[model samples]
Target: MILGRSAISMAIGIWSIVEQAVAQHASNNRAKGAPITKNVSMTRAVYTKLLREKVFPAIRKKWPGRKTTTIMVQQDNAGPHVQDDNADILEAGQEGGWDIQMVSQPPRSPDMNVLDLGFFLFVAVATIQDTFDTDGLIAAVKSSFAKVSYHTLEKCF
Candidate 1:
């Protein structure tokens, strides 16, 4: 899930859940060897596209009346996340004369991330109560994200 926060408001930018699929082969009515599972982890390219295509647009739509055009995006310190100098992200931020900056969270500080400590927990609880397949799980998680209150997110700060 992607979220935007400021002094006055907090909004969910993008919430997505992807499933990993495994390829299995049957041999003589028995399973043949181990299944090959495709990696579903987020990569730098995917994150960059998310920032450019999803987060930025949400920021613009949600905060069009804000006084400042500069938006600072705080991201977790993950290997797939983009650096501050990513060319595509920088260019996207510069669209419509807005300044967009990517900021990394401090190392070894899980509590510092609002999403990890708060929103994700809510989602996990909401999802855990339901019995759903992969597609259903994704839908339920997205619905749970929408159900989260902005006040709850604000309290995470």
Candidate 2:
């Protein structure tokens, strides 16, 4: 999902890369006609694509005030994550005169990466629901994200 916010705002929106497809093998454990959820591996190419197509647009759209606002996107030091100055990302960030840069969290500093702490909480809340299918699961996640209190988000940031 494309997650980041000003001190006053919530997440931009929920955007999972999951896709639905027919299950290759039916298991006795699964309910009849249950949907299958496939998670995509996050590669650098995939990550860069998301930044160009999803994150940059969302940030530009949701950011409050001023046309020339500069934004710093803070992410963890994951292998799939792109460098701060990736050419394609830099091009996307420079679009329409905006300056957006990706900054990685320092190594060996899990406490500094609070984004994951809150993000995982959202997942925990989502999984608590008795969702039966992809649509139901998506609804559950959206509901959970919607319920995130400003006070809670304030603490996370």
Candidate 3:
């Protein structure tokens, strides 16, 4: 998952054996100053690749001319994001064209990361309220997400 907080907006998705989670994040428009908009995906390698290659690139295109610095926060899962094959991503960033930072592992605390709580709230609020069919639930989740006004996000800080 791409856990970040900044002026620019971001997106994230998650696919677990039990369920799939997706979140679209934007910086709070009000006073606390603009924070990085983080796009995160909580999924295994296959899904994460789908999001990174297909989804992220498409979304990245919308923000033309914007420089994107990547920082990966990985949990102890066996996925491409955590595999050696993906080292090139960090290497590419270290090549000096873009800023890259990695969150430390081992003893890492998810609570310390704002995105952690953000993601939790996103999932909790999105899936709550009532039971529905697949499509209906999808609509409910989207509608719930839409209802998260700037005021709610600001309170997260």
Candidate 4:
């Protein structure tokens, strides 16, 4: 991988959107009468569901041009997102007759290192202070993401 500014500032398009789901079961504190739906962990099953039910559909609906274009979905080293999603994505892409592939992003890019992601860290910590519960946290994060514009992302690079 290149270690320069050019490597960090490539043409960017947001493909996968953030997904947050409520747990099927009640909170662990339910026995103490604090019952509430909790945010589910990012497990393989959950990621798979998001890819099949939400992401792919969204891509199909809003893709800029050519529905048959080869789409490369990039994800970080997150195990659930990269591990089996390759095979699963291949099969799903075939069923829909779309050329979709999941690619594991390199471990690091010079421009978007820890310093660039400081924007996210700041937003997360800033919003956490105003949130009181898991639901609030999720909402706050989603709101933060929604507010991010191309300008905001450009600053990161």
Model 1 per-residue lDDT tens digits across residues 24-111: 7765533656343333568887778778788888888777875266777777788998888888888898888778677777877856
Off by over 4 Å in 3: 1-3, 6-43, 68-108, 149-151
Q: Would you list the rank order by lDDT, best first? A: 2, 1, 4, 3
Query: What digit string (tens of lDDT, one per residue) describes model 3 on residues 84-109?
Result: 24564455434434434344444445
Model 2's C-alpha root-mean-square deviation from the true structure amounts to 3.2
TM-score of every model versus the real structure: 0.76, 0.78, 0.48, 0.65
Worst lDDT 10-window in candidate 2: 1-10
Minimum summed lDDT over a 10-residue window in model 1 is located at 30-39
RMSD for each of the candidates: 4.7, 3.2, 13.4, 6.3
lDDT of 2 by residue, 7-63 (tens): 234466667777776666668846545677877788998889888888888887887
Error of 4 at 141 (Å): 1.1
Q: Which candidate ranks first by lDDT, i.e. highest?
A: 2
The total of clashing pairs for model 1 equals 0
lDDT by residue (48-157, candidate 4, tens digit) is 87777766666666553635667666555666664635677678755567765666656665433533374476456658567876656667765655566545555554
- TM-score, model 4 to reference: 0.65
Q: Candidate 1: where are CA atoms >4 Å away?
A: 1-9, 17-39
lDDT of residue 54 for candidate 4:
68
